[model samples]
Target: MNTLRLAALEALLLTDPLQKVDAVNALHLELPVGAEQSIQDPGGIPGRPSHLEFVLPQKVPRRSVHTLQGRAALVHSLAHIEFNAINLALDIIWRYPNLSDRFYGGWLTVAKEEALHFSLLQAHLSTLGFNYGDFPCHDGLWEMAERTKDNLLARLALVPRTLEARGLDACPVVREKFAQAGDQQAAQILDVILRDEVGHVALGNYWYRRLCREQERCDFDTYQQLAKQHRAPRLRGPFNRPARLEAGFTERELQALEEQA
Candidate 1:
């Protein structure tokens, strides 16, 4: 039977935030098993709207949310992250093969949630007189995705665990900023994103451990190796221990993360 997943992945990579979200929402997530093979990487990178100007992380300007323009800038940045996340999840579903059907199923859920997040944030941006691509953004997230493109293990270890996990630590701080700025709705949107992220990170944590177990590798050691090999960004914290714990990180992992700082 033909899987709907590849078709859905293709749809996700098309341009325009609203239409892309609609495509994802239209997916039949359950009752479909992924095809084991028969796909080629896209000839070009995933589609993006023409207005988005990608720059180095250092080059992206930061603004205070005390002003309306500044608040919109912050929301635009969040929308960019969600946009890249949707691509990441879609990429994982199609790029990796020879795993349990559960793997594909799980990533599909991640993709759907990410699409929802992008839609939510994008809509909020509109209320603030901005759109997803109104400001320039850095390509750090997708850069890691490209680095991990050839190895599923590296992808799992770095993209989700190393990169996405940082969101767990960052959300609360951002939420408070939004609230202090008197943007209760913006803060609540962050609440939803943070809640969904815990589960996504948990899925990554689960599969990373699963893959390491099946490969007869030590989980902690393998993660370190992957981080070094991929030159992953150093994790910073003031971590949200409660969220990390909810996201399936053990105390041992938490300790290791702390020691990394």
Candidate 2:
């Protein structure tokens, strides 16, 4: 099989509702690139298993319910998100060529952590009598990736710091729900994800700062403008202040973010 182009790999990463196991296994394959005619054909890759089709969500719809099934479904959906996250991190390393070795190393670390998160969530989903693909999921995460593809600085700023940092803020609430439901296993899984995500976002922040330094610009103000220009969601609080601090967000930056909210 021919090695897929960056855009093709990115398309694969965005395919939503993928079975976690299938998606993980597909990482081992040499992805094929389609021709221009094939690309515009909309027929998708032939002879390749359609076990996963990553598509972006137009909007993030709010879901609310108070039932075990509903909770389990939500957990499965999050698991699917994490599965895509793993692929996204790996694809960054593979698809974006010619970066410093450290860049690849950083993304590799993220890939490993995302995989760990996926495994934890998938195991918990199994305990709930549902698997990773058993529930519908939004594709908002991958959408940001697509939007920032041409700008590495924007990709680092929006994806890890903005989008994934939202995960940091929301994780505590999700953990509380799992705890209330007496699903300590799921709660524990979320704990691991939260911890690792902080580091991932920190890596993003580090790179964003590096890029800013290279361009001789103000990181904080530039991030704010990019966030606005890209229509990035405004962050709300109660913030995970301690985690954000540990994740390389300065007090001034946090204050600026809070002011924006």
Candidate 3:
């Protein structure tokens, strides 16, 4: 397919609901078979939109989930988030242009991994007799993506490193909650996501630092200013130091982040 179509596909994937597995599957056919299949086998083609929309809607059920139904609802909520995350990665690749091919490759790899994560989570949700979108979810993650759309630097700094890295920080806590709830399978799934997300955050760091270097700026301080300017969420600590370090965060940078907290 042409580049425009590829980009449109990525956008559609972002808005499409997770319950339509066949529609998801067709997205694969829009690209070269091998490359598209590598993008997690979403089943449909994407169409173009003449305009963009932003709505701060909350759909996930807020009521307590004390029974089996509640557990399933929560699982589906998480699955929906992962589903959006997959498209976010793809959009980064298709929407932005003129970067090094490595940038495109990096995001494509991320998109595939995110798709895998979403599929795994969806399968687990199904076993509990709940599918994605069976419960309501917040639009917070995608909202951040929309906010960062115009500036790749801001996108790299905020979405992956800030918002997505927050996932890395909270994974352990979520795992503990799952264990407490005796959902060993869900806890194990979270473990896999945590391991992979470290790499994702690191990829964001890689690009952010690259941009800083290319532009001849101090990466750490710039990140600080961007966070404040964007009103991005303030980071909390008890950080996963090892994961952050592996994700290309320098010791000095980590110190700076801690100072901000």
- Best candidate (score: lDDT): 1
Q: Report the lDDT tens digits of candidate 3 across residue range 1-261.
A: 344336435555544445333333444333432232223335532221213232344534554444688778767767766776776776676556567656766776676677778888889888988766565566677778777777889999999988888888788977787788889998999998988899899899989998999999899889988888788977888777888888888899788778878
* CA shift of 166, model 3, Å: 0.7
Worst 10 residues of 1 by lDDT: 29-38
Native-referenced Cα lDDT, model 2: 0.70
Model 3 vs truth, CA RMSD: 5.9
Number of the top candidate by TM-score?
A: 1
What TM-score does prediction 2 earn? 0.79
Q: Per-residue CA lDDT of candidate 1, range 1-261, in tens?
A: 556567666765688777777776766656465666667776566667877898888888888989998899889889999998988887887777777878888888888999989988988999888788889999899899989999999999999998899999999999999999999999999999999999999999999999999999999899989999999998877889998998888899899889877
Ranking of all predicted structures according to TM-score, beginning with the best and ending with the worst? 1, 3, 2
Query: Residue 14 deviation, candidate 1, in Å?
Result: 0.3
Candidate 1 vs candidate 2: the TM-score winner is: 1
- Once fitted onto the true fold, the runs of candidate 3 whose alpha carbons sit more than 4 angstroms away are 4-66
Candidate 3's TM-score: 0.79
